[model samples]
Target: MSVLPDPGATRAVLIGTSHYDHLESLPAVSNNLTALAEALTGPTSWTLPQEHCTILSNPTTAEMTMAAVRAAAEQARDTVLIYFAGHGLVDPEGDLYLAMPQSKQRRVETGLPYRWIRQALLNGRADRCVVVLDCCYSGLALGTMGGPSDLADQAAVEGTFLLAAAAETRQALAPPDETCTAFTGELLDTLQTGIPNGPELIDFGALYRHLRIRLAAKGRPDPQARDRNTGARLALGRNLACLPTTATTPSADGEPATARSWPSPSGIRTVRGFFKSLADVRVTSGLTHQMVSQRSGGRISPGTVSRLLNRESLPKTWHTTAAFLSACGVPDQQVAEWYAVWTRLLTDTTTDAAPHTVPHPRQHQKPTTLQRLTGRLSRRNGRSRDHRSGSS
Candidate 1:
């Protein structure tokens, strides 16, 4: 339901560091910056003027800050997207810092504090801000609760949306032989080719979900996101892979062309019931684990499919569940319904950690997205308090 940002009123700044003086270099980052910049301004995307997009490759901390400042100075009224691909550093206190060519491990001053970037974006006039980070422990940008030194205080901005390549404790993968970093490579491909059966416009919400499923299927670190004030609803670009309506029209036989009927996960209240439902769906699909994985276009591994069905514990995240269902040919609308069911179960079982026990539903209705967000935020805030300090 999101609309594309006004092309003439938007600006993008892409920063990357491929060669590092004190840290291992990510040679693929250079490719990420170039390709991403082109894609953002390309015809298939926002089509912003070339001048509206800025690319900074292997820049110093000062240069990176200056570029952010200059982009902010543009005072874009619609949207401003800032992307960084390089080494992400964290101090012992668990503050996130972006590494530059001269950045050293555990040295906060040597790298660019994420706060500086956040401040710059907050200073801009843009109505919405999008931040994409592809690096080790990039999820730290989402925030932590470690006292004044913590990044939590700076986490929220009225219209900010963040997409991170990995969790706070995980390292983002950058396969050496690939042309681009693992996260950015998948991202760029998605932007260019678009998702099949996707909407006309590709929004951040869809983009984040796509990345999470694709990465998890490949056994890579899952991406994370935080959005405020519906920023995730901002459209990023057109969907090149959306099919024509005529192609989906019913055939002369009165049956819809290419119809697929998958089992519904409706009215399920217990973890055991959910697991049983998943088993039923798998059986109904009549596919081997390998076949399901293959149908997922390699987004879900055969082993992962096997474990998902066989494991007694309910899936902890919607990403895994949606990936499995989509691979089994479930429609998008049904997948969304499944998400609601998952959220209801998650909310009901929040106080009870034991997944095997069936908890009575707190309310006999599907939870709205806002309700789900509230529950998730509460849980994340709680976890942040107990989270241990670490560096990646």
Candidate 2:
């Protein structure tokens, strides 16, 4: 099962280049950046803070690198998402570079090499990184040094997902009459409207599938994707298309009408309160422990689920908690919130177990005979030696 990124710890950097010195201008690139930023930060999506989302329009190579470095440095625990919508240039050696405003055709030095971005993500502290490239030959980023189609030897950072707009040998489309680039326009539409009857959260895997089908149907370039360590399952936005039209009816997740009244895990600090919230969610889900275990993809056992609800202590691992919550039909956003609370509670528990400041008391003991004799001898010798020494 996939866990949603904590919006508070996630960062998004959107880069676009619309005008070029020696290449055709893409007037739609600007719109792509703006619309994407709103979609990522809006309430229906990850709810990422506006300040956490950086948009660079027609930036110099230096400016783009610095922004990526800053984001990588700041995001330590959650995810880092980098998006670029512009011209993709290939070097003589077939390596990919993202074109900048000052970039000239076939000039490698004028553009930003994809290796720089790759290195930044590798050096960063984020647990996962997502890269979306919407430009010509963007798919080259997924190609290994050995072969364009051989993904087995791809040297991507673990927990990284790469989505390219076109194949390594193809050019992404930018229809002159479209508001946004062909690839990004479809992406924006998906984020704003979402998949009909799809999962509640729009994960990378689902998004890629949607894009592949939609773009293919339009006779556009097929999108390419490479994922490591289940990064494609990471969800960054909500599926607005799945919103229920009426609250009185059972929703897609099979929750009862009164499921809306279930207890919330927000603002819960104590272990007991957390468990109580879990129990309430389970109760509202109307599923037996066995059913929950099955829904969890067998990550948690039925006995473990029962133990979790009956015990007042927090679960030893977040994997179990997440699976349990997901099985109970909790949304990914709420699951992320629960993760934050679980983290704090676990930290407090560990801190409380540390050694205290006050020393432990010890039993009183009498001095030994040898120590008393030595003390008396030292006192007599001090008086006699002082008097003799002064006379001398």
Candidate 3:
């Protein structure tokens, strides 16, 4: 029988390497491991026991790191999660490799091949195994090198779910002024805040859908997810609140870009009416759907704009509603009106009859890079696991 993960028995290893002699160093790496380890062991977060988690910073070799991972897999009674934030290189044969401090270009043997890690987790008895790749070439987690396909990796990688930071050929850019990679930044944010009006458990699919929307809205390369197990509903974290927290960005004249006040949609009676109101705003404001889509920086698509106008219901998140209204030239003072209408509809009786499931708008797949590999690569290493946890 497969062992189920008891909260206290879960094992995690968070790895981030910033020192690459041959590659430009990624400054956000160390910060990524620190923040993730904290959240995973947080009281109300994943809540994994402190000792069960490991942090490896600047691991010197492939064999040493994979050994630590395999040991964790053997010890984990239920769930296992391995999050790597650093450099990911693709060998000539198109296989993906994780970069370490001593890695050299074209020397595939010096880096940790992802398949080595994947095979270890697959052989383990953990009920759920999630690998989050927040590095360059992270897309290789899906086993696809060049692009994001409608179907995930051809190899049936059972028991492992992969979250890629970017499609092939796109870099998972670090936010210039922030301490975390752009992908990891949003991830930590979602883990901290949870979903808006979403369920208590933010499951895998739910988490990825939200990521898709947020990244697309920010005009960044979209992230991809591959879950081989259809029945897997792994919880990333619990909803910290029923409603998302509010923060305001003020304009030059001291005008709030996004109002923090919670809107009361009590007066709105139906989803149709709610969307119709937005449609009427477009007509009265004399703005076309294309204009609104462009204005949101392609966050909200023209197709979505049409759907919100023509369709009957709305998604639960505030991102879409806020983006839509902001694109509509809706004044700050009055933006709350549409927001209230959408918010109210969530609790109103009309939602029951309206088919309320939110649709995930698909992102366009990015181009793939095909670099040639000539010789076989080897793996070398030192001793045991190392790196201090941020927590006491």
Candidate 4:
């Protein structure tokens, strides 16, 4: 469904620091690593092959050197994901540093510098990269929110994305009694039980949104994410736990997941196009009408969903649109685009323009290539022409 290639092979580096020789010990840090490692290697989340994953728990300089050990996992065209959970510190100049067992205050050199980490990923041959930091000053790893995030140009900018749990000035909260920190707990929950309903393949940006909403409802700090998905979606993995199972596919019922592909049209154009595209994503996503209603917890009825997909008109409110989009596997970034298009079209067809008078480009023709650079897909002369984005 995405214009990009299926994310090649996957490799991940998991780091968690809890023990500091002089600073306070974070017992929850170790828990975060253990649970996350299981989820990554487990068939539910990233599904990273064991040999392809490197996990370091409170590792010392000798065991985990960010620069020296040029992890060869990036030597091939693959998806490189690196995750860190622990204490983070900012230097006098306000750069982020990862705190390991040997990290010391007032000495920036003793900590893992964000630049070196960036260099390590940049030097690799990975096709796509993801950096997730669950620490106080994680924002240092990537540019702060509202800064230029259109990194989809250089490998340093586009291929590699960053997800920080909190702002540079705030401390990452670790609520007592939870196996992991609050940020990671919400992250794990999203992976375990899909965003809307089933394990529809999605990018880090989508995951970050779900995590932010869940944490915010519980009075937690907002999470920040730097994305490369504005052009083409970069999915992490397909979690079987989130999808329905049939005789041929894996399910939450413990059936082994096998290789498969979901059905998705090339692209869409009008409000009618949105519903048609959404219906395709929903059916292939393995979520039934019953699953959709249950996931909505009775706020949405199955009959309503069936009628909504009839393409008679866009939903009357933003809440219904969000629930339907969630069920349809639409990411947070794309949801705004869908809603904007719906609002304009809904007004045109009802007020400014005659009903069913809007130009429905190629309502019956098949699309060839979807735009990789933009969301605009139009039909001219009965052929689809993509308004592509600039090269990344």
Name the top TM-score candidate: 2
How many pairs in model 4 have backbone atoms within 3 A of each other, for residues 3 or more apart or on separate chains, i.e. clashes? 6
Residue 28 lDDT in candidate 1: 86
Candidate 3 regions exceeding 4 Å error are 1-5, 138-156, 243-392
Candidate 3, residue 293: Cα displacement in angstroms equals: 53
Better of 1 and 4 by lDDT: 1
Q: What is the C-alpha RMSD of each candidate to the true structure, in Å?
A: 24.4, 11.8, 26.8, 20.6
* Location of the lowest summed lDDT over 10 successive residues in candidate 4: 143-152
For candidate 3, the per-residue lDDT at 203 reads: 67
Q: Tens digits of per-residue lDDT for model 3 on 9-103?
A: 46899888877777767777788888998888764355565787899999998878888799888887557888887777767776767889877
Question: TM-score for all predictions?
Answer: 0.58, 0.63, 0.57, 0.56
Candidate 2 C-alpha lDDT tens digits along 20-54: 77766778889999899988877556656678788
Candidate 1 lowest-lDDT run of ten: 141-150
lDDT of each: 0.71, 0.73, 0.66, 0.60
TM-score, predicted candidate 3 vs. hidden true structure: 0.57
Per-residue lDDT, model 1, residue 370, is 100
Residue pairs in collision within model 2: none
**Residues 263-361, candidate 4, lDDT per residue (tens digit)?**
332333345445545565465556677767765667778997787777456676778767766554455566776667667767755774565476768
Q: Cα lDDT of model 2 overall?
A: 0.73
**TM-score, candidate number 1:** 0.58
